[model samples]
Target: MPSKSSARLAALTVAAVCSAASAVALTSPAHADSVRIHDIQGSTRISSYAGQKVTDVAGIVTGVRTYGSSRGFWIQDPNPDDNPATSEGIFVFTSSTPKVAVGDSVTVTGTVSEYVPGGASSGNQSVTEITKPTVTTVSTGNAVPAPTVIDAKSVPARYAPAGDTAASGSINGLTLQPSTYALDYYESLEGMNVQVADARVVTATDPYSELWVTVKAHEHRTPSGGTLYGSYDSQNTGRLQIQSLGATADFPKANVGDMLTGTTAGPLDFNQFGGYTLVANQLGTLKSGGLQRETTKKQSRGELAVATYNVENLDPSDKTFDAHAAAIVNNLQSPDIVSLEEIQDNNGATDDGTVAADVTVNKLIDAIVAAGGPKYDWRSINPVNDQDGGEPGGNIRQVFLFNPERVSFVDRAGGDSTTAVGVTKVHGKAQLTASPGRIDPADDAWKSSRKPLAGEFVFRGRTVFVIANHLNSKGGDQGLTAQYQPPVRSSETQRHAQATLVNAFVKSILDVQKNADVIALGDMNDFEFSDTAKILEGHGELWSAIKSLPKSERYTYDYQGNQQVLDQILISPSIRRSCKFEYDSVHVNSEFNDQISDHDPQVLRFRP
Candidate 1:
């Protein structure tokens, strides 16, 4: 699970895994001892026998992992200690194909060590393992220990415990209380065999043969069957990632709401990326739940439809143009104005000083027309080559596509990637000095991030100002399953500043002309209930349209197993008060296994 390919292992690197394990190379002559697996695991997360040698640690091989960088065998003691604080099972890191089989009774002699994935700077939890293990198989065909069943009754409702402030809020030193906290419950069974019956898939199976399931059914469930991560306190603790010990191609391809029919049992592993996971040797049978992608109703002629979609670094070389065009035309119902994010250069990511995306954008336009949609005119400001933070060479920027038959783009001169758009008064109304301009391009808040693109549009003779944004991502933030309780989100600082800048810009426009029709929307890389969203809606300057929907239906993205809000459409008070507000967080990709993008498009329909 420490590989970088899967989401559950993104935080781990080979350097970190090797360094942590090999740091304590105190190799002494092996001496027979009565030391057990639990003695090495100890009560806390760190091993008490760390930097020491343990010989003749008896256990039965429960699972064998013969591939990947972490190729090893999981040995679980048949006769576990009475205490639930320490794990009975431990991983034998052979560093290659293991000469062991499941049900083999064996004794291992190795150096007890703590391998911290992603390094110590990452604040991730360290897994206790026996590195450089010399194992001797005592017998074969021994019955494995019965798996500890994990269900709604076993896992506690409380997600985590507050760490001691004296230790910088880290829970590493604290004793595990299995009945008090869910994290502790999972940690108590770390590396030991566990099972969940009839587990419902929350996150669709990813491309890397990984999926997520929840042991606690109906815990903050969405209408689409995903567990909701609506607030910080409600982190959906029942969710657990699943990976198999068998062939990767044999893994099930499941979507959200699909069911795992029988018992899904395996070694409960504490991973760096997705927290506690089931490295399943016995996988569950798949059963479809009839989940389908949703399509929004077409906008009436009287009502204006505006949508924001992240095409996920669309380029001329991508084959998803037709699928995206179908999603725009057929699913989004050909919105009058669409703010498309992540539009790359013509040769997308081929950094040859080529910044123009006419081919890329026009090809999509052509696909849209071919899909029986209107011939939409587009406007965008090309960003500096490789300045925006995305794929290294992909100059991803926001582009606006407006149908001339329904709406017209208010194009003015002198707007470029570096030029900041200024709000001014014209005929007792608000107007942009340069249409299709970047908002505060020189500001430090937008450094290494996509700058907000401000564009002007006229619909039914009423001017609407749209600011499309793709702010700084949530990189470098500690995950939910860090060594520290309430993991730190350092990336929120930049996003908060970005939100404040956008809020000020919106206020500036409203200051000149009260009740201006302004809509700020895009992949905010945050939740609607987050502080970033609160800053964007500062002093009621803008209202997040996503909140208009019920809490169960507000998600636009799926991460791990929690359905959350990363894309949003927010409107000024003018549209909120004057127009009949209607918003839909479109569900096309986030809930499907075959996804074109990780984010779902959001559409708002209103009359002005």
Candidate 2:
């Protein structure tokens, strides 16, 4: 299981820029020239003067940063250029502490380089930066240029232009169309000071001292006050990541639906995470939104309540144990069965030949019981040490918690990490040969990934098959704001194979008994609208339950402000034919600042 590298590589990158700067040093222009900022940043994504040195690039210091790995100052020309397709400012990358301050007009002589935030391999757009600078202050107390306003009407409705097919759908070769595409408009203002007034918070402030807001107020607003990321086609163009140039301690915390009152002005920067981010020099006041966590009602005696939650690589040593227990007890209403993802090894990430998760599972069960929940029993096979991918040594896997009073686990032993589970017919009923067994564990699809765990359960004398899965994540995929239009999903092929395996397993149970109740649930790690989901539902063997929610309420995970789905609960034909099921993508941790897990829990109440 891999994680998203967007935020991990998001912060203002300096080392890679310095590395790229040296690589292009040998390609200096034959003759040095005095070029305007607009001349340096051409009409395309890549700068026309890249790898060439410029003399006396004149501009006023709009913002300066002496902290962080990227210590530099943003400079903008007071006399603005007429063409909207070219930027009037650029970032002067000073290796150490910068000497310049705001309102100081400086002439810098430096090499114009295109620094791709997460490197070229990440498929991120290159940022035009003036690296290895020699700065000279022309005047003190000079007037900084007025900030450009970015609002609902300013950004284009369209996200980006189609890249040339010859270049493999890369939009870098295309000319900037600021009026027609949002990515082009943002590129036209790179490193220039801009502002958004009274922006609405679409994502809660993260521990990285960053948050996200939407300039387009009413664009795909969800009930929880976050913008919905419905599809790849409709990427909300107005969503911009906000990070302050101020101290991290002084940064304000806000939740979804909160407002940053007044104006937040800053220099537009292209980063690895969310593409165009505003490094705010002057931040706005934060106003509370009074957002609260949701609670689901208890299941009726006839209804079997089931839930899936990713505890975010949880171990016995984590501090969020009580909070997580509360969420399962109070918010989730203590479901009869729950599929818990990311339960780490016995010693957490120590990785000393340990594979058991008894300590990790027992602690959560104890906490649940202490929080007025049931004395739930659990079952799961320990993954082979370091074989499953996750936090290096933190061998995480899915564990099932069931209340013995309500349901009984079928104990047909011989389940292990590498053994594949198969379906057998018993008097016209479907049963697993080995309960709590891994599904197709020997296949390459489970290589360095968590294998789906299948278990047999009997509720009210009726057999049910539950497959808990934490599939391969979207780690190697290109981002939405990548230089290539629609970006590359390199991670999808492995996930597609994984989905096909699980779908075939579900089909096996149905082939024996068509009405077998099969419930596949957990962090699928792919969207409901994605090909992974489609493959998991192969030939109508299964149907994803998340689609039952309205398009606006379909998300269970929020990343860089766009709420989308990465967890799901899908059912077999018997369950779907009943048409008496209720699904809830409960909003708890995703919208709140104090969260135990990054993903929200999902609950399904149905009669089996």
Candidate 3:
């Protein structure tokens, strides 16, 4: 034997050389041709080679994601086969820092897999990928492939396929009909480079460096020249998501109705957030819409103004109290009686046994007085610990704040947090047995959700029954960018039930008194054209006050580039026949980046 140190070095060199030889041996194909990228990414939504080992997969590295948990690089074939439905590019999962460059040509050996983000409950589509890859570089400095153009001519006018049920819902089993539906068209261009030109902004730019756009001219436009969210039957086909690939500061800030000149070139990707996003490195110039904030004029004397506002999670610890008060005072014209929602308890998300909102409501009233507004008297019942469905530890409830000089509260006994209010005929008039009481609190529709608060108020010698409500939200529903065609709205079932209950209560009041001066208002968390609204308007029990305005000017909230109605005020037949009501949606929030609340309050001035 040789010396001790020399012998050890010789053994280590032998092991290293054997390791290099093993990698080449495992990756090299004996006599067969190399596997193409399209074969790995099949024509269907999922790959045919999933859960199988594949060798000699040749492609060029097109993109690299060096950060995050799912660190990987995307590879595309330099010469694509003649398969129109199959994609030529696929993602390789590394689970660490990526080791390849953008222009490197390589042959990879790995196991094919289908990765679903956030598990099965998310209802998101799975992405086909290669895991635990072994790479062998062949060349470098090659030219990238050209991007495919997507215009109005390329996309289909239809939205999705019919007869797809929620129990067995997927596009993987169906054939790709790119010329028939928008969802099919996007699936066909799944992992390819694409370009869009002369797009119109349909939604405002969000905080996540993303915006929605429509490539073609739209038929439905709002009064401000923005795109209107039509009914569910009319699907906006050419709509797409534009996501920035550069620094956050480099992205453009745009509002609805704005235009983007030139083209945006990027790779088409599907993720859990927004279904099909264009990850663009190059963006065009943004043309502004020149939209501005609006304020409503003050109400005339002797005209009682009733308003509804959703103060988003107001509490004592929050610092947005002054701004909200100013908006209510100046923008809303200091309404005589205001119904507020999302008012948290005194300790504000502390989770202790504190259920009183006196401190929270008092702070807002003090702020309003300092802003040169009149004194307001607030009334609300403290909720039991944490039954409401909202932020944890924050006991949120509905509250009413009124100008004591203009409107007087009609108080009665036997009203508590859990007691259900009963309706009765008093002197031939429908009246609440317990004023300011909860409506049907024991009903299944109100389980773990906000209960309707009913109050009787006397304004100018007329008694008006006001019911404050905040219904179930759209949290579990699919987004506008979901993979499924005509994305299913699963949250509507509960909202429909809630609407039925509210309709029954209204009918009870109208049965005793045909023309009861009823005004039901608050955050009804559904669209104006939704089924919930239809049930609320059944048999002409109440009319949506917002509908009295022109169609082009009937939105109280802005979300995802669509100005839609979420908060509404419904009036009785008597109120509608009068036609002496003036309605205004005070635009102090919902359009600007710096917003006090996510909603714009509504003020209805009528001589009751």
Candidate 4:
């Protein structure tokens, strides 16, 4: 039906119709006026009775929305088959009556009348004597489910920081604010996981005051007042609060890199920063995994750092680090920890041209160790054995390289291997094939299972967590667009999964170390603004370090007619100190060697 004001216009239309009919009678019988309505369907029965009045019309209330404070509402049977869903059904001039909510099954009765085609009423053909008006409930409707409280740990591995949930890691600097507030929104959650992502928390004044925390979740009320919840967990949780207990027990004590987990009881209210109003309950402490023990000591005072690169299938025939090892060994651009992607391995055979063929991945490590320039080390390797590459066999590309000189490794694990990490449930293909997951290019089957690799690194002054990833390649035998689009081929789908796993892993890290300095680096296949990059940058917890640099140096990889910044070096805000981070696009790979690998090695230079 038309809105309340629209209904009044309908009345005016009827009056005009009557005037036109009177004029027609005075003129000639052949020139009489008439009203026309499109698709009367259920109202067709009344069309036959030409001038008869329709006191009551009935059908399901498919759509409804209240307008103008609480004046009146527009109700319609969105069903295409039912033609009685006209804009002029029964105009309820509810200037004094209560307003109506959407989805209310109502029976409206009024004096029926037709509107003249153009001279009088234009859209609707009705004038009813609103009687027997009543609204009932929809039948056989699905019940709304209760809101599912999510733990920070429940987020996917790709999103979590390295060693998130580990008991030993710590967050050093924490500054809270007072004049903070929350925002009200339901869709497109991009900055809800961490507090610093949206608003900066100034130093706390009362000392006992709780720091405002936010959560992300979707909330909706059904026709029957039943509430439905969706995964708004991305960036919607508004500002809530948490209190301090003792040394390591206080919430503020949680380092800049510590992850905190909780559920939203309702929308966040800034007034309740340190308390548990919007929060349903506290999950536990957020910690990057325990520190790893260093087998070697620090030789150079160079600032300990981690960097990611897309070596473009570093699987060379010569299979020795000596080819591009100079970039990794040279102190001017060498990184303490390096996260690499597209690293291919031999089929455990001695031929067929593989990078690890002559000198396995282990040999590269030995060479770096033998040279002993700055003295580096490594962590666990998921390797090609861990992937499902189908008939071709799982020649998996991975993330595993570190510096033992400045950092120590206490322990390591992969997949959703620990209680504090991993996904509890994975929606089946049917749930995602045609849904929102489809809009996302990364939503593929095989890729979801491959997962990302994470590790814990300890520096003398600070413990930095590292998350290394090499998401699915944007281009395959198919093309770049297919990397994230659906109807996903196994290969393309796996790459999408790689992107997803990385997103979840980072989210997990934020869960444990809200403000901890985390470094997420690898070959993400796409540009910095692509969906994959947006997922990590959505929450301000991590920023692409290169983005802070000059635009000319922003790019990390190049291709035919296109030069994109595919590889990324992201870091937590707190880590901005102790380092003036920069990426050197050393043309080593593209130099005289006719390309050391497909990708130019990105050199991250960080000086204390």
TM-score of each candidate structure, all chains considered together? 0.96, 0.97, 0.88, 0.41
Ranking of predictions according to TM-score: 2, 1, 3, 4
Q: Candidate 3, residues 365-393: lDDT per residue as tens digits?
A: 99999998889998887787887766667
Q: Provide the overall lDDT of each model, using Cα atoms, as 2-decimal numbers.
A: 0.87, 0.88, 0.75, 0.36
In candidate 1, stretches whose alpha carbon ends up further than 4 angstroms from where it belongs are 1-17, 21-33
What is candidate 4's local distance difference test score? 0.36
Considering lDDT, where higher is better, how would the candidates rank from best to worst? Answer: 2, 1, 3, 4
How many clashing pairs in candidate 4?
Answer: 67
Query: What's the C-alpha lDDT at position 289 in model 1?
Result: 90
lDDT digits (tens) for residues 308-379 of candidate 4: 655544443445466445556653245677766555565532334332322345566666666654455554
Clashes of each: 0, 0, 1, 67
RMSD of 4: 25.4
Q: Best-fitting candidate, measured by lDDT?
A: 2
Query: What TM-score does candidate 2 reach?
Result: 0.97
Which predicted model would earn the best TM-score? 2
Name the better of 2 and 3 by TM-score: 2
Model 2 agreement with the true structure over 23-54: per-residue lDDT tens digits: 32334464468888888888888887888889
